[model samples]
Target: MTATRPDPEIPAKLLAWYDKHARALPWRAMPGEPAPDPYRVWLSEIMLQQTTVAAVKPYFAAFTQRWPDVAALANASDEDVMAAWAGLGYYSRARNLVKAARFVAELGGFPETEEGLRALPGVGDYTAAAIAAIAFGRRAVVVDANVERVVARLFAIEEPLPGARKAIRAAADRITPDERSGDFAQAMMDLGSRICTPRAPRCDACPLAADCAARGHDPQRLPVKAPKKVKPVRRGRAFWIEREGCVWLVQRAPEGMLGGMRALPDDGWSAAGDGSGEPPLVGAWQEAGVVRHTFTHFVIGLSVRRYDGAPATVSGKGEWWPIDRLDEAGLPTLFAKAARLARAASERLL
Candidate 1:
């Protein structure tokens, strides 16, 4: 697949289209406007990974309101940031966001180049390119999922994803104009999200439809994806120890899955297929229910059990959280589901 397909006029056409149709996103700067705050761009890109804009909008708003800037986010407590980031699946991103914030704050400001930005704690190749092209007016090839689809369709790169990304990225680079590179990258995103949608692309309205090789030939199928492998299902258990209107919660060790987030004391199981661990304490425990959660690589069936001892014999390094205020504890989605089931099964807690 040749990098420069059809012509070099793709960026010009795309940028012209963007000036009138750029999305009014909270984190994005409109076309022809000054670049947006680098902090917002970085934060939004991190949140947007494996997450949709619709889903990220409210979280982005809340986080920006709370943290405001890199310095404010850096000054925030780990627990506070983690709590605020609850329900946004990838817990590790929140943890890394903290590390990167502190690093950037200490360094005075965000690095302007893609290579420099990639040094941030959790920033990856795609994120670094996006931040550079969008925040610093850098002429970087930004190939996000949307851009991948657009470029693949434009060049009719029939190769499947993961492998075809290289060719698609190369094609995108040829079309990425030097001037207003930020706007060009964003324009491709808008074109893909709106005109070249995954299903039923509106080719007639696309500015680049004239040069699209996949046009009038089922363009939706251009960016083929490899088949998904069967995910292994693992089983685990969660314990609910309640006493005197308080449920026990413990902080996960600062590594591995869901690390540093406050959650229910479980059987030391983090999506493992191993035998379950012993309960926190020996007591007459009743089976409450199961909480089913699906991760990217696997599925987990977390069995919830309740300790119904008279004194609720609890001995552990955890806090007694009031049942009514459990919502504020910021338990990750899985633990939150388990807590709700435990609460529903017990009448004495609330």
Candidate 2:
């Protein structure tokens, strides 16, 4: 077992690339300026998990604009926070974000060590390492999807993802520079995202082309991945009745898929069957339509039911809505689909 040193040329090669090609992101601290506030970096990283940079910018700006600090975030009402996070998806992340912010504030601020970061809600090893290295200049290896692709191709590893994760981490650590570990980590991510892309790799323009293992093999074929599990289809019934132009909407439970967002009133859903028990809607509920949506783990089939009578708004701390004002309610995409289906059905019947 020998220690691995950074490639003598890699740091220079990658740093040069980073200087010229770094993505212009709002959360990023300027080159010479002190690193961004730990709260900002940590918060943004947590939000950015499994989400794209372009999708996260406006959400990031809104969150920082409202809270601006860990203490403020910790003190915000769950409703306000959830409302701010409505369109971003992954409501649990928003919930944990506030929880972690409060936890950190109680402890003074974000812990400088990786261990401290790991202890926060939703901050896993990769996230902790990223924050420790990028924000504090710690010599920690950060392996995201982008970094994973770069590492796998550089070493020509063929093992599928998740299983190949450990080997990729080791390889990334081997090449990560100790001095500017932060820049090195960013460089790996940049290289994968921009140059060594998933489909077509720009090997001709890659800075590390000389040492790339996949250069000899096929650059596009080196980083092989396991086939994805087919998302299981699940079914449910959503009641989308409207009264006096105000539609009825209910808040989803504070956990699980589509949590903390306003949605059409629905019965419980399961993988093996349609919703169990009686639905919340009343007065000869009619099957308005069916809406299909796919989640990360499963596909959902929703039976859209509609009721046109007096407004019944007692759906667990939710509100009745003027159907036309649906946009102001901040419904997620799934609910958006349901709303559209129900509205169209109501018009066709009348």
Candidate 3:
């Protein structure tokens, strides 16, 4: 499938718009500025996957401040990185980030090409292209979600996504200029995010408005998406064992859902268990409440049960995390929500 070239003026117009309206992201180097550090670019791109820019900002800042560079990240322990990335969702990305950091550190520096970057863990086509263009000043075409939307709208591509991705990439390739390719890619992203939005696109403010085929049509409907499969709802149970002002928090298995994060002991809830599993302790367990959390594949209702028995008898491969400093334990969002529910129940009992 061949993609027709976009209007020759599109690049210049878009670059002009980008020069004025480029987002002031922590990891981005402004137009005409030196390329951003590859480490920062790589880190931000990994974190930004399926995540919002607003949500990623603090995480980016935190990770960079703590690790500072690829070497530092490589040297950090896996538990520490996983904990820091707890609420960010997608535990695997954090794992891969550490692995890739070690790989890069061993190689002595980041690879400068998309193909080379792709060889690293977690650096897929989009990420490799983004790093190559934005961090290494390469002419690679970078197509992210925002760029996909802008391209789809600009060319009025009507095919549904996943299927339309090929044409979208070709269209993106057509518009990506040889000069300042990184800036061009960022410009398209900024345009899509700020002006050519999913709904109620600001066509009047768009630099590519003159060339956009979807501009006259219902632009919002250009990039049609196939229906999403309904996420299955699952039920589970989590135990809140408290003693001496601290809670029993266990580290998850090294591999699987929410792997390696510190979490409240539970009846194997991570597998979407039927909530019928026995409590870790053999004692009176009272229902604290339920905590609802959504994972990628399923939604779960975790029944928070409190241990009414003596804590001294409960034994496990876990730590006694202070209830007051539960925040520092780096529990995943699901467990974090469960903790809040249990804490409220304990307060009521007090």
Candidate 4:
């Protein structure tokens, strides 16, 4: 793909600004930090998906220290890896992370070209391009959210998201430089994150201010977005059976939503309209309360039911633990939130 030359002064402008004001992040090595490590960059990118840099910082530090390298991550057990990613929300990303690590480890290293990177388990068009350019110093275009906003507003494109994503990608490709591709990619990413913010973008400090179509006309309204699709609501029941200050917790199925994460014993949730399924427990059930949680595409309403004088074991699955020690378990955020609500209500009713 032909790369577009940003205004001759744009790169010079952006790099100068970056030199003075780049956010200090751990994953970011300074200009000469042994060139970019494809393994580290790939790992950080995967973990950063749909997660904020602040939220991902601790997890990234922990993982790098514990595993240290792609080969170490590849050899980690599923349980260990999942536990390490406990509160990051999207469990699938963690699973894919390990899969990709193993694949790359076996192959010796990440592909230096976009096509080769795309062949890895979770690497898509954007990710492949990012790795190819940022880590391997290849001339590839990267159009992440930051880059998209920068491109969309720069050209004053009004297409909605997802629909507009492709055009934005094309536009970004045009501006990427053949030389210093790594620095060029980082420069754009940094510019978008810092100056070209979605709200109240600091146009005065922007390097491409002269070429910015949005700034030239109406910066605030350039990159228009279509309305978001409504997320569906889902419902289910969670059995909060407690005895002697201990709560019953279950491990989700090995595959599927919230898979392998620790959770309260629950009636399998359904996407349908009603929630009348059998409680994932035995004994006379009573309505304790209800807890509601929202996922990206769906909202989940979990009705809390309480069972008293229940047997020590539920026969076929999960484990019961001291209620106070729930923190030690690898529970996802949603379930952990629900558990807190359930326990407080349980205390109130008793």
| Candidate 2 backbone collisions, by pair | 245-323, 246-321, 246-322
- Count backbone clashes in candidate 4: 1
Using TM-score as the measure, which candidate wins?
3
TM-score per candidate: 0.94, 0.91, 0.95, 0.89
Off by over 4 Å in 3: 1-5, 270-273, 313-316
lDDT of 1 by residue, 254-314 (tens): 7888888899888766555733658888878888899889988888889999975425446
Expressed as tens digits, the lDDT of each residue in 134-166 for candidate 4 is 788788887778888889988777887778888
TM-score attained by model 2: 0.91
Error of 2 at 328 (Å): 3.9
lDDT of 3 by residue, 1-350 (tens): 98566789899999999999898999999988999899999999999889999989999999999999999999999988998999998898988989999999999999999999999998999999989998998999898889889999999999999899999998888888999998998888888889988889999999888898988899988689888888888788899988888888899887788877888888765544565678887878889898887777888988998874455756778887788988888999988889888888888998
lDDT of 4: 0.78
Q: Which ten residues in a row have the lowest lDDT in candidate 2?
A: 310-319
lDDT of 1 at 122: 83
| Weakest lDDT window of 10 consecutive positions for candidate 3 | 268-277
lDDT of 1: 0.88
State the lDDT at 101 in candidate 1.
98
Task: Please provide, for model 2 over 1-350, each residue's C-alpha lDDT reduced to its tens digit, 9 standing for 90 to 100.
Answer: 98544467877889888888887678777555577788888988988899988889998998899899999999998777877787778888888888998899899988988988999998998899989988898989898988888888877888977789888888887778787777778778878878999888989989899887778687777567767888778888887767787877778877877787777778888555668636674478777788898777888898888888855555566677887767778788888888888888888997
Local lDDT at 95 for model 2:
85
